[model samples]
Target: MKTLLRTLLIPALALITLGAIYFLSAFLGMIIPVGPEKEEYPKEVEIFVHTNGLHADFVLPTTHEVHDWKDVLEGKHFGEFETPYLSIGWGEKNFYLNTPTMADLTAPTLVKALFLPSTSAMHVDYMYGKPREGDHASSIWISEQMYLELVDYILGTFELEDGKAILIDHDGYYDYDQFYRAKGKYHAFWTCNNWTNRGLKKIGLRNSLWTPMDWGVFYYLEK
Candidate 1:
């Protein structure tokens, strides 16, 4: 018994020692500044709808950085809920988060809050090609109601001339012609895929509990 115990103790101690070294190294790595960290972009919690005819101006939230979406969601106290939508704002990025209409709207005209410049948007690196399986840029997980409403608005408001609607891409970088064509080519990527559109279809709602992946980006439609 003594011999066996002695033999086991040596390897156990080595493992413990190695674990300590690894923990220390990992802890140090977090603190040691590597490259210039990306500063958290400002976000707005509330939106104000000016009386003017112009669209509402979204407020800016505090300029704070976080390690991941988990941190952002945890702080909000709605930890039990999962976000339904995922979107990224390019430089001056624009994409519909929820459907907008003259009815079921609070503002006199139309107010939609666009949560933009999210950290998720910043994390993406892109090129003009079909997004891969794990392409974060391609997948947007939106709740069913918001998805349908957006689709309705898209189908109703915009006339899809030449088999395409005007989509906001990479900050509307291309002219109207290019933007329309891009949407025609990449409609499924933005609208359908994964458990997103399917999940939305399963649970039919007019305005599903669709929240942004970075829930921080939105613009008020009527406000």
Candidate 2:
């Protein structure tokens, strides 16, 4: 009786404690400001930030005056998806590869994702057309320099070998997408949504001061 009670009580208390810390940190982090005091550069590139209500992705044009991703995100690497825009997202390796949907998530996977700083992967989805502004998507325009800065930050995240992204041999959630090994570890402090926010911050765009949630990143976007 005592052993059983201890086991249950300890995990329950730990969960409660972690939950409190997460929310409290998020609230404070979002409030604290980062980035330029004002956006002065002319908006030259239009990009999309997309969320499935949970994870966020940085959606950029496949080919643009600023940069061309044709050779990098080649169609031959994945199924044909030579669309106008490509959506890139980062997440824990096990979670991204194993859990295709929320329903597929398991207790061990969730626990490992939140607490463990494990391997990460980049999920690239090629879009057929420009995403219309809707509940799940939002568009923002930034300067050419800012866009280039974003390019550097994002492209740098990939675990490139021989000056190229190492393709992972796995099917995407959709036929038009593929996965690549990425730099960095996914854990409590830096999540997929947080990666979007960080990129926005790097480009002097509007973003949450800090966020682990997708909604927070979109919520702080320019109205």
Candidate 3:
């Protein structure tokens, strides 16, 4: 019995230590400003970052000066309702398809996400109404150039086939939404929230140094 206890103790302590270090580093990364200083834009464009407890999405206008989102997303996927904003999110394909809600989440899905190189998908949600003030959303005002750069960064995430997004044939939880095959592989380190953080960094926006969770991404945005 003593031998068995000793065998279990070391691995248990090691896991606890690793967990502590990961959370500590994530907290530090959330607070630290690692990118370029926030700059003022003459011509402001309203973009938003929204969080639903665990996941994060980057919301952009449907029609910008440089890019017509409809040109890529199309009206067919969005249904009859005309939406003003498009909310985009990325995640592991198996987890996304299998676990639409918290109730559907399984241990196997989570274990696969953490241990394996999983296929990725992008969730596109069309919003008719704007994000209200004091919502679970952070609004950022950026220049036209910055907006263009941000759009380009988002477009690059899509795995294009013949200059078009490869739409995944799956019904999303919401009405005005769909999923598409994304470029990157989803893993323990490179999560959905991390993707949002990288997108903000790409456009030279104020963002966390390294965020693997939704709250971590929202912390600096709220500040």
The whole-model lDDT of each prediction reads 0.26, 0.85, 0.84
Tens-place lDDT digits, model 1, residues 118-154: 2111111112222332212222233334344434432
Tens-digit per-residue lDDT, 1-223, candidate 2: 9999999999999989989998999988886777655657787899999987778998999888979876566446334434788899998989999888999999999989999998999998888877778888898888888889999999899988776778898988876788999999999899998998999998877667889988778776745
List, residue by residue over 108-191, the lDDT tens digit for candidate 3: 999898779899999888888667646589888888888889888888999887767888888888777888889889987899
- Which candidate leads the pack in TM-score? 3
Task: State residue 130's C-alpha deviation in candidate 2, in Å.
Answer: 1.9
| Clashing pairs for predicted structure model 2, backbone only | none
* Model 3 collision count: 0
What is candidate 1's CA lDDT for residue 92? Answer: 14
For model 2 the TM-score comes to: 0.92
List where candidate 2 sits over 4 angstroms from the true fold: 1-7, 77-81
Residue 81 of candidate 1: its Cα lDDT? 36
Each candidate's clash count: 27, 0, 0
Error of 3 at 9 (Å): 3.4
